[model samples]
Every structure is written in C-alpha cells, then in structure tokens.
Target: MTFTYQMTVEDAVSFQKELIHHTEEHERRRKVWMKYMRAILIGIGYVGTLFFPYRPESTALHILTAVTVGFLFALLLTPLLNDLYAPYMLRLNRRFLQKSQTWPKETTLQFYETHVEVHSVSTNIHRTTQVPWASIKKVNEDETYRFLYYEEDEALIIPKARQGISEAEQLEIDQTLEKYLSTSPNV
Candidate 1:
C-alpha cells in the first residue's frame, strides 16, 4: 500500500516532535560505547585501591585512591544526566517550532517489498529519495500517526487518523509493513 498526502506545517511540527522522542528512545536502546570506558575506569580504580596502602602512614595516597575512584564513578554516572535532559530538550524543540514552517506540498510514496520510495514536492523543493528496509531502524506510532524512523534526521510520518482508512484496510497495511519492516505498530 502507498500513501500520497501533503503534510501541513503543523504536521511537520508533530513530525519534529516524534523525531525527538524517537531519538531519546534510540539513545536508551542503542549500543552504549560508555560501557568500555566505565569498565576501564573501574579497573584503574581497583588497581589504585590494591596498590595504595590504606594506613595512617600513607594518608595522602589513601585519599588519592578514594578521590580517583570517586571521580571515575562520577564519570560513569554521567550518562544518566542525558535521561534527565531529554525531556527538557523535547520541550524546547516543541517551543522552537511555535511558528508554522513550510513542508512538502505533495509527496509520492511507493511501498515495495522491502523499501519505500519517496518523491517530495513543495513550492521550494523537489526531490526523490529511496529508503530501503534495512535503513528503517524502527517503526513507531502515536494516536494519530505512524512514523517510520530511518535516522535521527529522516522519517516518514503517515497520518493514520487523517486519512480515515477503514480498520480492515489499516490492518492489512499494518501487516504488510510489519512483514517487511520487522516491527509491528500499536495501531
């Protein structure tokens, strides 16, 4: 199944919000390179604890070991800060696009067995892009729209509620996408 519809600036704004949310989700689920850093830090901290004498004769060295471990532990805990800031960044993105901006006035979409080709048309822009199934890392949906997330900067948003697609039709489309994309929608 294919959908050809032009999205309004409001829809674009919603797309932006979903992108932000998807980013946060990706960060949470994606591979964390920090694990290696944390392991190295812990190992160094442990070495310090083992080599340094913990006696009154070596008070400064004992303090140095404690400080090193504390500092490294602090560094290990820094990723949690991003979780705290994600919601704030999401809110800021919503506020940033308070004014409506122009989006593609029309789009031509062709859903294939494992890819979707997009031809974009707007007053200012005209381009065609092909996104393969492998590039689609995630499929997400909200109450009103389904988002096919390719990357942080690219996604295809289908307005499920606006099209007034019948439930049977929606189910069939869902099954088709699920078959190719390997992710099922909550729709």
Candidate 2:
C-alpha cells in the first residue's frame, strides 16, 4: 500500500531532534568537523596578527578576519563533504522524511495506520527505488517521535501526526520489526 502526506516544520524539527537523540554518536560526526572548523578559525586569528600585515584595531579586524575565513571554510567544506557522502546521507534523510510524513497533518495519530512508498520529487531526472517492509530492521521511540531503522543502522523518524497510529498499532509495527531483529525505543 502507498500513502501520501506532507509534514509541517514543527513535525520535521521534532523528528530530527528525536532521531538525533537516538542516533549513534558516530552518525553525528559532522559536529567534529564543525569543531575543527572553529579551532581553525581561532588559529587564523592568531596567524592574522603575524601575517595579515594590518594592525589590530581593538581586535575587531582579528575577529572579522577569523570569521570571514571560518565562514568560507564552512561553505566550501560542507558542500564538498556532503557531496562525497551524498548518496548515503540522502538515503538516511529520505527515510527520516518519509516516515515523518506518513500521516496527514489533520489526522490524529491514534485514528489510522499509515503505509508509504516515496518517489523522489525530481523535475528533470529519471530515477526509481523501493523499500519493502521486509527490509525494515528496527524501531526506536524517543520523547517525541519514532525511528525506524533499516539497512545497516540507518533510520527514519515517524512524527506524531504520521504515527496516526494508535499505541496499539505502534506496538504492532514494533512486533513486526522484531521479526527482523530485537527492537527497542531507547532514544
């Protein structure tokens, strides 16, 4: 069966936060790169004093030079790295978005069950993919949402609205997930 839906910003944010809570620390490695970028900017400020050939006017230039360099570094590095890892991260993000959109905005989570099949919204490209229930590996519930993990620890979050499923239905899905492996909602 296929379900169609859209998610609001609130739903998306809730799902992202819950998934982040449940995700392995390794999945958040982006923060390490972010910290490295911050450290490099600090280093740039130190070097600017020696190499910028400009006198520091109340440390404002130091701050500006460091910030400009850091902003550029983040802009350059984020795209390049995201591109290199695009396919894998795209899959993960897609899963999360799909799950979050499983139910309609007007629906109460306890009123219905949802099943979905997503086709990427592409304007000029031809592509196709599918994920059957059999492939789902795990289900984890957090304070605000649920993460359905599949394919090598990857996961998708189910927003409360989409979870339009009753707690009983949620448990039913959990039972199904258990057939693939043990299930838990630790996040």
Top candidate on TM-score is 1
lDDT of 1 by residue, 1-187 (tens): 6667776666666776666555656465333434554665666665666664454457687666766785677486668644544455556665665543445368766789768888778767788878898888777788877888788667887666555456676677677686787766643
Q: What would you estimate as the lDDT of candidate 1?
A: 0.67
Residues 68-164, candidate 2: write the lDDT tens digits.
7656655656655544443444457656766753433332211112222344333344333344555566666756566666654455545433444
Kindly report which residue stretches of model 1 are placed more than 4 angstroms away from their true locations once superposed. 24-101, 164-169
**TM-score of each predicted structure versus truth:** 0.54, 0.39
Scanning candidate 1 in windows of ten residues, the lowest lDDT window is 28-37
Candidates in order have lDDT scores of 0.67, 0.51
lDDT value for model 2: 0.51
lDDT winner = 1
User: lDDT of model 1 at residue 22?
Assistant: 57
